[model samples]
Target: MHIITRCEEMKIWSLRKNKTPMLHYFLFAYWFILLVWQNLGAGGSANRGGMDVVIKCGLLVMLMIYYFMHATGIRRDILLMCMLLVGVYAIVKIEGGLDLSKILYYFFPFLFVLLIFGVGWKFELNKRQLVHLCNMLIVVVSYIAVYALIFCTDQFANAFSIDNAYGNELKSFLMSSHEYGMYLVFGIMAIILCMEFDPEGTKNRRFWYFLALILFSVNLILTFSRTSILSLAVLLIFYVLIFAKKRLRNWFLILAGIAVLMVLVIPSLRNFFWEIVMKENNDAGRDALIDFGMAFYRDGSVSQKLFGWDYAPIKAYLASSRGLGSFHNAYVQQIVANGLLGVFIMIMYSVVTLYDIFRTIKTKKEGSHLSKFFISFAASAVVFMTFNTAALFASAIDSYFMTLFTVVVPKYVNQSIRAGTFDVPIKNRETRPNVRRVYR
Candidate 1:
């Protein structure tokens, strides 16, 4: 057979075994594109450039395709239709026909994820074949984390034409200033990598995973994104405390490594770390943005205040408010644009999700730490928004992190473990003579 024919045969064999090559490739592609987006910004070769647009459109198309292929019954179809309708309404109300960054990049992913996966994507990911796909994804993400830490440059700073001083400080750790949002996504990936590649459990894989974490941590500090840093910090702490077996030893070493790294490689990072905890000067500016954001809520016209001044409105408002206006808070931005209803819907959805996942964690006997890590990442993302406004927005990396954690990771892990046919052993009453007596 020709080489092409031979390759096709292999592909067919893989698919026949129930392996999802497309989804694995897609996950890898997403991770790779995110790395490029973070490092290369939104310009350049058509394939790599305008990736923010590509990611949104690609995700929308992918999810829609997945929905049609995987749709179960009438209920899912109806729910998806309603979601699409709401998205369309919000899109029209916000920008009519997808012209604004806020519409295409910010809002679409949420709608797409909700419609495609909300009904039962969780069940779809339960297959063993799908779990292997997820493991492949985690490996790919670990690779990206390591790559981002080592090769990433200040390309991001020059892309946005941000102030040189800030660039000088930030560019060293960040891949791209223009795509700092993606950095938060990277942070989420790092958490997953850690969860899947546990040291004691996973054996040799632990070394690479630990290295991945260090690289990610360094990148987070170097990126100087308060949101990413804080999110990762919260996530790591949760993972170590709740998930890490031999908890005291594991956490102590992890903390010691971080402390030593701060002391040795970059002393300045210690200050940066503390600054995160204390919310210092630079942090103060962010709070001021919130204050001003709230003022818009308190002082703007009823419509502007209630319906949200919109991104454009904020630019217009800012063009007048000391030559600038920004809805620097994401939740506030939602309240401003969609009114209390939009905000309430968002809160309700998030609360429901958290409750469901936590319940799932409690009931499922499989990987509790993995579940906790997944939950922590998702929860951390929701909390991260209080510091930065992009958590709800499509283009903002926070939403990506949220979707990945809430929708992707859990489904991927659960399905993979289940698919592997690894049974969670139930104690057999026959084996334990005292079991019945104890129970009685």
Candidate 2:
């Protein structure tokens, strides 16, 4: 009787310990669902006036609660700097007499950035928990893939159909094909990281990851996004080069060579590649846009040049000139809207983040799982940001992935330092190798 009572007590204790994380997992699922639904036009089409506001407000509350529950001391400086920038921008916009509602709309995305970092700071995951998170992501992507496959069969079948210009692209109920591509790429990258880091797992884990890779890869290709495809390809190459064992790297090189040879030798493959990747002169107008933005900045008055243009002014200018609002390139957009000071701030943020990653790598054990995953994620993010604007100042899903790595990397390093897992010495090291590592 005593033994049975002890076992029962232990079971209850285990359940109590797990309850919070389980709740977190469910909350994350809900958050992800909202992200997808918002991108899917469900919230936009159904509740254009009020539902969207309710959803955003509700999500903001949930994020705040979640952050408080799991918040840690990591990345407080970055958070503060971000908040400072937002405040400055708000002041500038308000001073320029921009619409109050528009100002709030512009500020909303930064809040998501804060929420993401908070989640990352407090994210403590055991191997099982990490696996569970990956599984949740995989399931979401798979559902999107299947939905697109089933409902858009005719679109998929006729790649060049004139019926719909985007018939070949797999939007997957998303607002745009590019958005769908980004989500697929992010999902695929996460699965790849999980598979690489946690290879020796439960039965058939590798198989499942491999299957998911193929599925997401196909879906990504179907999106027909040149930038996303390039980003994914670059990330994959970096992953193998940086993380793979010597023998594995050799095999990867050989496979890459074979793929290139096949593309060159096969006529149909060459034509397909040319049509999909090489035929599009996507950069044709981008240079002109950059030039125009620079001229506009140059011609502005002293105050206008210093602060650049407010959102309303920029929107009006674009409407009158090109009938399109975006500056296309994030760097150019910042220059046009926020001037040199804004550009400087952004550069500082990127430099600090990159420096943090560099410092962590120096202290981390060679081939450490955390280091490899962080590097892979950072590579993807850097590439994505270079060619895309979603992660720059938008509260899109792509931005969340970038924010996740920034927070998670610091948290991992902090934990490792506390545990003395880092290879570098904590104390005087002049007598040792002249190497220093710090997370400032």
> lDDT: which candidate is best?
2
Task: List TM-score per model, in order.
Answer: 0.67, 0.77
Candidate 2: give the clashing pairs. none
- Identify the runs in model 2 with alpha carbons over 4 angstroms from their true place: 1-31, 40-54, 72-87, 98-101, 105-127, 160-167, 302-306, 316-325, 365-367, 405-440
Worst 10 residues of 2 by lDDT: 9-18
Task: Supply candidate 1's per-residue lDDT for 80.
Answer: 57
User: How much is the lDDT of residue 399 in candidate 2?
Assistant: 54
Name the Cα RMSD for model 1: 11.0
Which residue runs does candidate 1 get wrong by more than 4 Å? Answer: 1-41, 44-55, 74-110, 117-122, 126-165, 171-204, 248-281, 299-307, 316-326, 393-398, 411-440
- Candidate 1: tens digits of C-alpha lDDT, residues 1-440: 32222222111112112223255445445545655565456544344545566675775567456444433322444365556646645754554444546566435645644543453342323323334444555565455545554555543323233332243434332334313434534444554554454334447565655565565455445555556566666766666666656866476778779876875577555444444323353653556666776776777676555445456656676568644344556687676655665576567556755655566576565553355656665657665666555544244444554555555656655544443322322121122111112111
Residue 67's lDDT within candidate 2 is: 55
